[model samples]
Target: MSILASSFHEGPLLDKYNNLLISHERYRAMFDNIPLAYMSMNENAAIIDFNNAFSELTGYSCEEVYMKPFSFFLYDKKDIEYHVNVTFPRFKRNGFARNQPWKLKHKSGREIYVIVHGNVRYDTDGRFIQTHCLIVDVTEQRLAREECQRAESKAQLILDVISERVTFHDREHHVLWANKNARSNAAPEC
Candidate 1:
């Protein structure tokens, strides 16, 4: 039902159809440019199809990955094994999995970290048909976190070896961490 009624649309339905058609065309123009990668797999877990973002993220052409097991793109051996043996089966049973971590290797051998959100489709009779999934690329975020960890570890190691008393604290002045010398100095005398 449309908002303007009095005379009932004021004209034929052609104007309304034209408005809808124009709106759809504008949306279709943006569809291919969306940044979130999308993919779908058959019930067998084969890579059936993916969007342009997926192709850009993995550096693989549709022809190259077509019909391959989804796990085949994983970067680590353990991840591949776990996906095939655990995650896939769990998703099939649950019909949905969200924000599941995965590491995919690009065609150029770069590792890409991602969070997968997926849902399975079923036939009217309840047989599994396929899965629709979104792949959120998180490689830069993961790399930054790992880098920060390494930096902290290196700083801690240096602090541990120094003779000077060093302590880290929050704004409240409570000791959060104290290096070896700082710890010994704070200890009570026997």
Candidate 2:
């Protein structure tokens, strides 16, 4: 028998209930499928739930991490210090945090750099309940940026050693950068 036919008779109430069920199902599907990592932690910072992406990122299954102190994942001393001294205090006061960078220890014992966006939840009685976090892995981006800076520094070193004066300019001929040699060898103003 069709679900509509089987479930307590068809009526406006049934239709409304069906629509709400469908909407909830759709929301669950999207939450599970989205690439971004999402997690919720209870007031004490214990893990409540996390999406698939978060599980993959942390290398910890929901079953393994559920109700565990989320702070246990933070292994780096610098990251821990910053989180405790700066991030947590700020978040507590503001009830939200954004673009907060921290490192988490993966299940494989490697550090994973992440940026977190979070919101705190409170009960009507002014009690803390849970906080939601949207985390993004930025390890690759940080490495690429460091690599780029190194390459630029190496190029600059080479440019500085050369005999020719090298000055970078904008389209309007405004000077943006000058190599060390360029600066030293620049002609004095008339």
Candidate 3:
């Protein structure tokens, strides 16, 4: 007999129990070790559990966040209002929210931009249980985009100030942008 068969004379009952234990362990390992931040909140939106990555991302210990409202970390009043009025209601209705961006306040008072995915959980009886959320820190990505936009705006300003007529066109031969001189010098379409 195989070791598992020999060890468990209780047959399928013990096998099922063992399988459940193994599955639970695997899920716990994944939940704790995944690089992205993960958290679960109670039906009232209070934090119930979170992973080490979440603690590190928000700079708050698990103890500090536990039992606190999820909105406690929102950086702005308007954001809090939006979450309460818009996001939560939509999540409740749809049971899932994907890749929605929000700003959270880090413990050190820095704003952390994150893209969040949330799913509402229900009991076997269809009663609401809690919400599970995955948070990906996108602060660096957002800042980089802002910097690029600023650079483009500065370049456009330089182009506009020059005396030369400059126009930018897409591959389809449609004008995307034109410097001030180019716009002023262009003939009216017949």
State which candidate has the highest TM-score.
Answer: 3
lDDT of 1 by residue, 43-149 (tens): 77898877788888999887887888988789999998999899999998899999999999999999999999999999998889989999999999999999999
What is every candidate's alpha-carbon RMSD to the true fold? 6.9, 4.7, 4.7
Off by over 4 Å in 3: 1-19
Least accurate 10 contiguous residues by lDDT in model 2: 4-13
lDDT-sorted candidate list, best first: 3, 1, 2
Candidate with better lDDT, 1 vs 2:
1
lDDT of 2 at 29: 92
RMSD (Cα, Å) of model 3: 4.7
TM-score of 2: 0.79
- Report the C-alpha lDDT of model 3 over 1-190, residue by residue, as the tens digit: 9987776868787888899999999999998888999998887778899998999999998789899887999999999999888988788778899999889999999999999998999889877788899999999999999999999999999999999999989999999999999999999999
The TM-scores, one per candidate, come to 0.80, 0.79, 0.87
Q: Which candidate gets the maximum lDDT versus the true structure?
A: 3
User: How close to the true structure is residue 37 of candidate 1, measured as C-alpha lDDT?
Assistant: 91
**Model 1's TM-score against the true structure:** 0.80
Model 1: pairs clashing at backbone N, Cα or C within 3 Å? none
On a 0 to 100 scale, what is the lDDT of residue 137 in model 2?
96
Evaluated against the true structure, the overall lDDT of model 2 is 0.85
